[model samples]
Target: MRVTLKLATSLDGRIATGSGESKWITGEAARVEGHRLRAGHDAVMVGVETVLADDPELTVRLPRSDEIRQPLRVVLDSRLRTPATARLANPGTMILTAAEPRPVGTAEVERVEAPDGRPAPAPALEALARRGCASVLIEGGGQVAASFLGAGLVDRLEWFRAPILLGGDGRPCVAALALAKLADAPKFRRVSAEPVGDDLWERYDAIR
Candidate 1:
């Protein structure tokens, strides 16, 4: 299976301002494209921080429809810190915990389930791939996204560049890497770039 990384950020590469206030950072076109992409995925994954901060449902919906495409939601709560009230605790979801989790309701629980004792995402991802999840979409804050990028597990990328410049202190939308590490950089060939209000929707492929 393939894992695709998706995110929207300010042109200055900030996911959120220093105050942690951000919404609608991308234009309508970017959101629409995101929904369309979601329609094709079997599941979506996010970190515990994202679940607490955003509480996203990760459903695919269009303007004219009341129904939504529900995918198996996976949470990367390495220490099982996710609260009971989080949206991901609802049915049709899987709670992947590295350790025993708190009693967070009766929703089905799936352990990290890796061949090795390691709880790193790559093995969990491979398990998902074996389950016929052709692609996994990762919608998250910087840390989770950075983990995949650093490991070279990302097969594709979709980034929306907002017009605003939050400047330096804003949390960087992407994680950091050493300059020498870039020698193994993933090749991204731009597939599309169109203006979305003051923002720009960009799509890339990991051709290398």
Candidate 2:
């Protein structure tokens, strides 16, 4: 499956403030573009941390209502940290967990678990494929995005950089890397950037 890491951040490369607070970091243009990008993907993925912090419904909202398409919501919570009341638990909910499957009603879902010792989240992606998802859009809070990059699972990155400077200790916009080695991933580069109000939408291609 094609995996795309999508996120919006301040110019200083902060996803949020020290208190883990972030709202309207990017302008509406980037937001709309993200929604449109979501419509073309099969599902949008994020970590349990994001669900806990933002409680986002993760639905695609196009500028024009007629352009909307509801994508499946996938959460990477190895320990099953998602709250029972989370909106993510309602629709095409997928939890990447390290726990036993639960009995549920009204949710078409699958669990993506990394074994005690193993490689590949492919099995999880395969499960999604069985459910008809051809691609994955990874929305992030930081760690989740880095994990995918570290695991070499991300194929693309769509980022929106806003003009504000949020210099806080919350986390770097990209937190997975230690920065000791610059060529770690060795296969990602910015390919495009466009003005979207005060923010810029940038696209990067990840080499395999």
Candidate 3:
């Protein structure tokens, strides 16, 4: 399966304010474009932290189209921290965790053991493929995006940059990487860069 990391950040590379307020990082046009992008993927994924912060529905909230395709919502909560009342606990949602499968609202809880602290993207991507997911859109809050990127699992990156700046005190767009050398960093080749309303949409091909 192909994994695409999508992110919206300020000019200073911050996804949110210092106080965790991330309601609108980009413009309305960018948000609608994001929803349209989600509609093309087989599944949409995020981390437990994102869930706790946003409680996003994870649904493709766009205008009705002739070919409507709603992607499955996938959550990575290795410890099963995702609450039953979470907004993503709908019928089309799937939770991956190390704990035993427990009943959550219409969603399926699958046991995904990660011996290490980080959940292995290989197995998770394999599982997604087994369920007929050819493509996955990862909309995250730093850690999750870093996990996939660090694991060399991301195939593409869609970054939306707004003109506003959040300064150094804001939350970064991505988490820290444990790279020993500068050459060890994940690299990407820019595929396209276009202006999306007041925001800039950049697409990159992940260099494996």
Candidate 4:
């Protein structure tokens, strides 16, 4: 599947404050553009920590249009910790977990092999591919972003950066890759950069 990692953060590449407040980091235009990006993808994904923290709907909220189809929502919940009452626990959402098969509200649950307790990116993508997902937009909370990028699965990046700064204590957009050398770092070639209201939207494609 074509994996696109999307990040909306502050100028310092921080997704949230030191205390975890992340609402309205970017302007309305950037968020609208984000929804458009989601509309273009076949599925949208996030790690379980994001669900537990933000409880986002993960659905496209564009203006009413018959052409708009909500993408399938996918969650990487290895331990099956996502509560059934979460906003995403409904039809059209799928939870890929490594835990024993069981019901999670009305959402579909699929068990995948994860030896490390966390579902690996490649196998998770395979599961989505089996479900006929041609493209996936990974809209994150750090660890998920790192996992995909570290696995060399991200095909494109759609990053939105606001003008404000959140400092070193703030939460980063991507968790550490634990690279031992600078040459081992995953590289991306800049595709485009443009302003979206008070935020800057940057696009890139994986160097590979």
Displacement of residue 192 (Cα, Å) in model 4 is: 0.6
By lDDT, the best candidate is 4
For 1-208, candidate 4 gives per-residue lDDT tens digits of 8999999999999999999999989999999999999999999999998999899999899889356988999999989999999999889999999999789889999998787798889999999999999999999979999999999999999999999999999999999999999999999999999999988999999998
Give all candidates' CA lDDT scores: 0.76, 0.77, 0.88, 0.94
* TM-score for each model: 0.87, 0.88, 0.96, 0.98
Q: Over 4 Å off in model 4, which ranges?
A: none
How well does model 2 score by local distance difference test?
0.77
Model 4 clash number: 0
lDDT of 1 by residue, 1-208 (tens): 6788888898898888788877777778778878877877898888878888788777777775366666677777767767788777777666676776566665456577443342567776876776667788988878778777777788888888988888899888777644466566656788988886667878888775
Q: What CA RMSD would candidate 1 show?
A: 2.6
lDDT, model 4, position 200: 97
Given candidate 3, what's the lDDT at residue 103? 85
Candidate 4, overall lDDT? 0.94
Q: Which 10-residue window in model 2 sums to the lowest lDDT?
A: 111-120
Model 3 lowest lDDT segment of ten:
111-120
lDDT of 2 by residue, 17-41 (tens): 8987788789888888888888889
